[model samples]
Target: MMQYRFPENFWWGSASSGPQSEGATLRDGKSATIWDKWFDESPNRFFNQVGPQDTSTFYDHFRSDIQLMKQLNHNTFRTSIAWARLIPNGTGEVNPLAVRFYNDMLDELLANGIEPFINLFHFDMPLCMQEKGGWESREVVDAYADFAETCFRLFGGKVKFWFTFNEPIVPVEGGYLYDFHYPNVVDFRRAATVAYHTMLAHAKAVQRYRALQQEGQIGIVLNLTPSYPRSQHPSDLQASKIADLFFNRSFLDPAVKGEYPAELVELLKQYDQLPHCEAGDAELLAQGKVDLLGVNYYQPRRVKARANAVNPASPFMPEWFFDYYEMPGRKMNPHRGWEIYEKGIYDILINLRDNYGNIPSYISENGMGVEGEEKFLVEGQIQDDYRIKFVSDHLQWLHKGISENCACKGYHLWTFIDNWSWSNAYKNRYGFVQLDLATQKRTIKKSGEWFADVSRNNGF
Candidate 1:
């Protein structure tokens, strides 16, 4: 509290997605998404078997939700449009009801004095698209650009900040390696191809948005995991460098600089598994650097060189290059099991300021997800002291970065309300507001009050 306050124009708010918050998927003639498809196949995968249909029911309560947002002192609100809802078949037909729904929602947000920051894709691909190879096909990239162009034409006037996708790498890890998401496959070649096509799709979307001359800013949100070697040993340092090349630079270099890291390319070439690319793909990527960047930094990667001999029979893994170093006494998220290092947030901003161009950016998604959150509720309000502490600590580092002239604009929580996380369901709550799934009631958490004050005063 001793140092400084953020600038006046900082965009303060929270974020959510259509698939996560807005239930009533079956009612609006909306076809199923990958989540819907997954729940149908394996109900046991989700926590308490809770699926998308049992979400926060924002579809019916959006008007009142906007009023609640005003009470929370939000200057901006981020939400995604469901691709399945936009085009039920994802190509041929447009759902008029879906168009009306989004239009009304955007209008209400504007009327409530909250700027709408819309995201086109948020990891919920339409089930129909997934049935056709999804991002693996070049045709799907064209479809995504078509979808994005349609959104810009429809909501460009009200939505000032547009994000092409949220945490693109999550799918590669979740779907390919971990089997936590739908279409789960543990193939490194497919992972490389998926990663390549996602970046291409992002560039394609941005190019279309600019071509349309829309009255908004288009950017992509990347979850940056900065790498730290466990020790000063040569092998450990080399391991960290390779980890950085694959995890961070693989996308960061292409997104910010429009070219993948040379080391990453060499690694792919070694396997003879590089993704298919056209002659003009590199030029297209270079032409569409984002106007703004949304950074989602949760933690840093602690790495050490592979101490043991590599397993000859083991399946392909990112861990082959390095081992996860468990640093003793590192702070951890009590409920979610993620490490909490407030300095990581500052380090991320400084990296962007130094290595990546000092692009206009902000914390897009960063919050602690706690289990059994209802136990902390007090008299109908959630007394989320832990969440408040988390945000306060992160904000202090953010403020320091700002003081050092890092081009940060503001901080947005991971979410606005407790919503359906893809496979985890209600296992972890990362919302500023507690959502009662059964009753559709929204209660402001203790952290929401802290954020409101930060928004009101422009700082703590």
Candidate 2:
């Protein structure tokens, strides 16, 4: 086998979020977020009733976790600053405890020779801001801008890489369209509004970051699922294109090119789903072009033209023009039930290279989640050979992309440790270090050991 070497100084780490890892949900002056509220209202919605408060307790054990990261030879790590924790009221006096915690955490990471890539939001919207109509209201957008600016002003010096949001589309799909998230509203128009406002917020954050003259780079983390047509037919090709427009280009265009795709705009207009945009919005988005992009690839989207007639009375949706096509013989991740498509990573990079000016990017989040992962535990440590293989497969394609001058700079897995996930909670574990939730013990898995060597060598 050929040695899969990466570029010099290639970043190797993992991505986590405040809402998922930090267990002190309401402690240290943190206000309620949508996660806290939803879990309070319906604990049954979460796996085994495990709420946000029952996470890995990073807030309490960050020192040990940082040590674990050092042991793993991580060069960089990505996590978010909880808006609810930073500003309890959404816009008021900054919480001193939150500031102290983040400052100490960032300094500790720096002292450990690890670079901290900080994100401003990660779907843990402050409940107060959500009450103000979430992303639909321009007021919440302004508040988010303020929160982002606060993050840059407070920690911009220590953190050189900043992201405006992580998977910003998840909220639109989970909250507005799919009913998997809080404020579960199944309305396409509302989903469009949320999506549009999120990009606007992202642009505003970038604008503010540049205005402050921060010596740092700011970008947005998007989970880009490359859309693949089921057949060579024109209808199938058109269907895949539409799906790509709705899910990928909707955010990618504005964040990179500083404008929305013309086809997306026309499609939304045709469906009467055009989001309400304020004056000067175009210029604002134009200013939102990022210096970096974080790409999270796990699966590819297979689609084909809709085979059945549409009901005029039904609410409009992206699917009105396309239908999901599950390709036969596709590789699968049995536990997560998601397609295992390693080549999709290369496809995304190639697309960026050929179409989007080859933006400087990194694989910010990619990992396999296994339900009942404890079944693989052996001799007090998880023999996660499956995970090791999963990562190696993806990195093989990532190396191919980089060799072809894709401009992809690094690779970060989905997580470093087993932590609480939204709704699913800890039902599926995606981590290199397994956390004994019962005793707060951390054990490095086989993959973690393997990754340490890969990071040290900058290859496998």
Candidate 3:
């Protein structure tokens, strides 16, 4: 049998977001987030009319949940601090109750020997800030900076790992282009502006964190979909490279290297879609490079050159330059419909090693989401052998990368327990511990037990 030992002191944990897991949306002076407001306005947008108000009830069950972390042999865990919960209005006075809740939660996790990795934003923008244009307006950017500063000063002692945003592009895609998230608008220029301003906000947060001289490592979590060409043909290769530039490098470059890809800049300029930039914005980005990076890999993008040219009269979009090509014979996750390409993880780590100065990084989020997971329940425990295989395969590749001197540090699964996923709600379950929503109960699945062994033994 092959050994699967990981590096010493590797972080064994899971990743979660406040909006997706924490309930009590209205308790203790918590105000409305964009998700809360959107659900109220259009309940139909979310799956089964479920909203963000009542999730896994983590707000009330955090202590018990930390105990669950200990049961799973987790030494480190990642969860976001809902911006709306802390600064309900997106500015002005901080909520004392919110501060108390987070402090207590942090203390509980630390008390149980689980290192807490806290993220600042996870797409739950305060409703008041959205009314002021959210990421598009500079006013909201300043407000977010103030919010980051407050968090560092308030809870910087207990928390050692901080992330500015989680999958920032998802908002630009969902809200601005795809119309899945709130304030849905399909304007390419608006999407570009939102993307740019989000980077600015992240930079501002990093600047504030550094200014405080916080002991923790601050970073950003990005879902990087490596683009693969359908064939080695020049057109197809160019298409794939362009897709990578847009989806991956757009954020990766700025967050790590304190710069943007020039090719992307030229492409935007060619389309007359470059976002409006301000003085000192470049300086701010340069000064705010992260100390660590969290990579969330789930799928790969296969692209080919557009068969037909897009009409110049139509509004610009990222897909206007390339087309998605579904490769036949590609292995797929039958439950989630995502292509199963484990090599993408190794490729990303290698790219970071060769191009990004070998920055410290980790597998922030990777998992398989199975729909109707209750059917797998065997004697009241989910027999998630498929999840186990999925994780094991990915870990094999991650281990290879570490052997090659990649600065990869840890592996955090997509989540700790089955929690609410934005509009999808509970349609697709991706957790080692199965959650019984009806009883608010958490049960460790077969995969969870296996993972506990993996963590305890430092390998399989």
Candidate 4:
């Protein structure tokens, strides 16, 4: 195998979230979130009929969890603060217990020599706020900015990096388009509105962080899947371009360049679906280019021209141009059915290098998730060679990008332990540490041991 060394001070760690890990939801005076609402309304949508209680009990085992981080040779850890945990109502009273809990978690991570990267939101919107239109309403954006400001004021000195949102499009498409979340709707116009407001909330949060005078970096995380057409036919090329515009540039151009692509804007306008914008939105976004970028590359999108003719009088649809193509021979994660293309990471990095100004960036969430992962059992441990291969292959491309002077600094896998995945529940496990749902016990996998060596050596 080839070898490449990472830069000095490069981050190596695992990422997790509070909603997925903190099971004592009601215990900490934390109110319900959109996830809670969804589960309440329909429990059958979740895999294995699991719910939040199946969350990886990190709220109880965080001290041990941080210890596990040290054993894994990690120098950084990415985690989220549950907004409802801090402000059960999304405004006014602050939960002192929630504050103490987070303070202790941060202290433990730092005490173990792991730098803490905190993100403010990760799709767990407070149910109270969601009832008021969620991100679709300008009021929710203001509330979010307030929430960001409060977190900074409380934890700015201790937190070195803060992120405003994580995988912003997931909510728009999953909830609004695919009916996978609370208040599920399949209207494309509403999806467009949700996307616009989410970006606005991001800008407003950035603006607030600037006002608070924190001496740390803040950014948004986009799950960017580089789009590739199935072939060079003209229609295929056009279809691929539209997919990229919607999935990539919708957030990339605004968050990075502070403006939307002209074609995207025109397309939205022609459909009378452009979001309601404030007078200063342009200036706010322009002045709000992030201090850093978090790239979450899981797979590349393979597209082909539509298989059928278009209706000349029908309303605008992103699908009128392109359809997804399931290419043959691409590696597959049989556990959860997502294509595995390691070079996709390199393509994303190179695009950033040439087109996106080579912004300071790093992989925030990339990992292999497996279903019924425990069955691959060894002598009291899971022998996850597939997971190890996943990281190694992705790192090979990452090493390539770094060798060519791409601005990427580090690699953080999708998770630290098997935690609750929104609709999937505990079905797809992506973790170095395995969480026994019955007892909430933490155990290291064979790959976890291998990762410790990877971190200690700084290369492979």
Clashing pairs in 2: none
Taking all chains together, each candidate's TM-score versus the true structure is: 0.97, 0.99, 0.99, 0.97
On TM-score, the stronger of 1 and 3 is: 3
Tell me the deviation in Å of residue 364 in model 3: 0.6
Per-residue lDDT of 316 in model 1: 72
lDDT of 3 by residue, 114-194 (tens): 999999999999999999999989999999999999999999999999999999999999999989998889998999999
lDDT of 2 by residue, 1-460 (tens): 3399888899999999999999999999999999999999999999999999999899999988999999999999999999999999999789999999999999999999999999999999999999999999999999999999999989989999999999999999999998899988899999999999999999999999999998889899999999999999999999999999989999999999999999899878987889998899999999999999999988899999899999989877778889999999999998889999999999999999999999999999999999999999889999999899999999999999999999999999999999899999999999999999899999999999999999998998
Number of clashes recorded per candidate:
0, 0, 0, 0
* Deviation (Å) of 334 in candidate 2: 1.6
Measured with C-alpha atoms, the lDDT of residue 168 in candidate 4 is 93
Error of 4 at 126 (Å): 0.4
Name the best candidate (by lDDT).
2
lDDT against the true structure, per candidate, is: 0.87, 0.94, 0.92, 0.88
Worst 10 residues of 4 by lDDT: 312-321
Judged by whole-model lDDT over C-alpha atoms, candidate 4 comes out at 0.88
Tell me the tens digit of each residue's lDDT in model 1 across 239-262.
999888878887788888888888
Q: Give the runs in model 2 whose Cα sits over 4 Å from its true position.
A: none
